[model samples]
Target: MNQPLPQRNEPFRPGETALLLVDMQRIWLEPGADPSHPERGPDHYFYRHTAAETIPNQERLLKAARANGVEVLHTIIQSLTEDGRDRSLDHKLTPIHIPPSQPEGLPVTSLAPAGDEIMLPKTSSGVFNSTNIDYVLKNLGIRYLIVVGIMTDQCVDMAVRDAADRGYLVTCVSDACASATQERHDTALNAFGGYCWVADTDTVIARIEALGKSA
Candidate 1:
C-alpha cells in the first residue's frame, strides 16, 4: 500500500503569513486609467467584475489581514528602464510596458498600500522570477502566502504556482482575483487548484480572525 502524504490543516499564523496583492495597478483595475482600458469601455465585463466583486473582496481581505497583523505586500507590473530594456523576454514579446513613473503604475486608491507596507515592482508575470520576493519573504520569516489580485490567469497564477513550488504554503482568494474574462479566471483557478488551497474572501477572513483569536 502506498503511504499517504501528510496533510496540512493548521490555521494561518499572523507573523508567518502574508497577503500578496498581485498587479493591482490602476492601468489594469481602473477603467480609463489606461488608454486601452478606455477602449475596452466602462461596461466591459472585466471592469464590472472588478468593481462589483474583486475590489470589494480585496478590501475585506485587507481589513482582516491588517487587523490580524498579517504582513501585506503589493506587486505592480512596471519596467525598470525607460526604454523597456529591463523587462523579461515574455513581457517584451507581449509588448507589456508600463513606465516606472506612469500613473498607471500606481495601485488603485481604495486598496492602496498603507504605511510601511512593501510594494514590489516587477517586469515579469511571475514575481518570484523577476523580483527578490523570495528573499524578502524569507527574511520576514513568512511561510504562508494569501494571494489576491488582477489577471488571475497570468500574474496571479504565476505567483501561486511559483510560491508553492518554492515551498511556501499558498492560499488563493478566488473572489479577490479576476481576469479578462470569467471563463479565463475560472479555468486558471481550476488549473492551478492543485498548487494551493483555494478559498473565498469570507472563508479566508474567517480563518484570519480565527488565527487572531488563537494568538
Candidate 2:
C-alpha cells in the first residue's frame, strides 16, 4: 500500500491571507463588452457557466472574505500606455490589447473592487509577470492566497502555479473560475492540481466564516 502525501491543510488566518480575483473584467464576463468575439454570446458555455456557477460562487467567496476581514485584491488586463506599447511581447503577439481607458478592461460591475481594495492592472496572462504583485503581496504580509477568476486555463492557471513557485500557499476556488468550455476548465485544474489545493467555493467560504468564529 502507498502512503498518502503530507498535506498543508492549515487553517486560513485572516490577516495573512488574501482573495485574488484574476481578470474578471467586463471584456471576458460580459459577452457584449467584446464585440470582436461575437461567437461568445449570452448562451455560450462560458457565459452560461459563469452566470450559473462562477459569479455566484465568487460572490459568496467575496462576501465571506470581506466579512471575515481577509485582504481582497483584483487584477484586470489593461495596458499602461494608451497605444499599448507597454504590453508584453506575448500579449502583442496574441493581439490582446486593452487600452488604458477601455471600459471593457474594467472589472465587471457585480464583482467590482470595493473600498480600499487593491487593483493591479497587467498586460500579461500572469499577474506576477506583468505587475508588482509579488512585492505588494509580500509587503502586505499575505502568505496564503485564495484565487478565483476567468479563463481558468490561462490566467487562473498561471496565477496558481506562479504563486506556488513564489512560495505562497495557494487555494484555487474551482467553481469560482470559468473557461471557454467545461473541458478546458477541468483539464486546467487537473494540470495544475499539484501546485495548489483545489477547493470548491462552499468549502472556502466555510473556512473563511470559521475564521471569524475562531477569533
Candidate 3:
C-alpha cells in the first residue's frame, strides 16, 4: 500500500485536491503596471525579485497542474465598486491601496485562466471571506488545497490560515508565492508553517503526480 503523504496524510486526498492561485493579478505581478508602479520603481528591489522568482515558479506549477488534470482555481483581489463601499476594513486602512481593475483585475498574462477554470473574485485578503470559494470547494468534495500566488505575506498567508481553520488540508508552494519583501515572505511562512505544510514547486509537483483518486 502507498504510504500516506509525509504529514497530515489522511485528509490530503488527491482526487479532492484543488490548486488555488491567489492574487496573481497584473497589478501585483507586472513590473510597469499602474497599481504596482510605486512598488516597482527603479529603486524597488522587492518587486524586482518577486517578478523574477515568483512568476517563473508559478508558471511551472501551473504547467504541472494542467498536465495532471488537477483542478486549478484562481483568486484575484479587487474592490467591487468605484466608491470603495465594498472594500474590507484592512483594505481601507492601507495607506495606498490599489483599486480593483476594470471588468475584474488584469491577471498576469501567463497565469490567465482558460475560459472554464474557476476564478474567485474577492474584496478581502482572506479568499474564503469575500468569495464563494469555500462553498465551491465543499460542493466539489474537495478536502485539500495546493496554494500558490502573489504577495505571500498578505493574501496567500491569510488564505492559508483561513483554509486550515475551515478544515481544509493545505500545502503552500513557498517558491510559487511572493511578498512585498523577502523578510515578509519568510515571516509569513514561518508563522503559518504550523497550520500547513510548506513545500516548493518541485515537491508539490511530485506530490501531485503521485496522488491517487479516492474511490
The clash number for model 1 is 0
Greater TM-score among 2 and 3 belongs to: 2
Q: Model 3: what TM-score?
A: 0.85
In candidate 2, stretches whose alpha carbon ends up further than 4 angstroms from where it belongs are 1-6
- How do the residues 1-215 of candidate 1 rate in per-residue lDDT, one tens digit apiece? 99975343357876898999998888887777765555787898999999999999999899988988899999999998888899989888977899887976889898899999999999988999999999999999998899999899999999999999998999999999999999999999999999999999998999888868978
The lDDT of model 3 is 0.78
Task: Assess each prediction's global lDDT (C-alpha) against the native.
Answer: 0.90, 0.90, 0.78
Candidate 1 weakest lDDT stretch, 10 residues: 5-14
> Best candidate, TM-score-wise?
2
> In model 3, which residue pairs have backbone atoms overlapping below 3 Å?
152-178
Give a tens-digit lDDT track for model 2, residues 10-89: 78876888999999888888877775687677888888898889998998899999999899999999999999999999
Model 1 residue 201 CA deviation (Å) reads: 0.4
**Which pairs, if any, clash in model 1?**
none
